[model samples]
Target: MKYSKIFQYAYIVFAVLFIYDAISKYMSNGDIYYPSILLAALAIFIFFFRKRFSKKFDNRDNSK
Candidate 1:
């Protein structure tokens, strides 16, 4: 549970970094960086997946 929470927060941090990278690339090159966009998407997916996983774990604990 603790690890899950840590990873969830880590995903958020990665998302922020990816977004910053994308913006910086855009500002410097005037072109979209596809890899950064993809990484941002993956980070978002992981963030939501962690949320759902945590909820499931909570529900299981409550049922005990």
Candidate 2:
């Protein structure tokens, strides 16, 4: 099951952004909040859905 490189990169970017946001939020409040959890969930969800999401887009964009 091959996946698109764009999807892979999107996951990486989402992870990094989430991590940064989580850390910033935690540092500002000295505790984890909903945003951090949400970001983490977003990262995980993106990873889990990468293949499916990419396939959908790929099929939709078929040039033929």
**Candidate of highest TM-score:** 1
Candidate 2: regions farther than 4 A off:
1-3, 52-64
Q: Candidate 2, overall lDDT?
A: 0.73
List clash counts for every candidate, in order: 0, 0
Q: Tens digits of per-residue lDDT for model 2 on 1-64? A: 3436666667767777877887897898887767756876777777768767776878888955
CA-lDDT, candidates in order: 0.92, 0.73
Alpha-carbon TM-score of each model against the true structure: 0.90, 0.50
Judging by lDDT against the true structure, name the best candidate: 1
* Clashing residue pairs for model 2: none
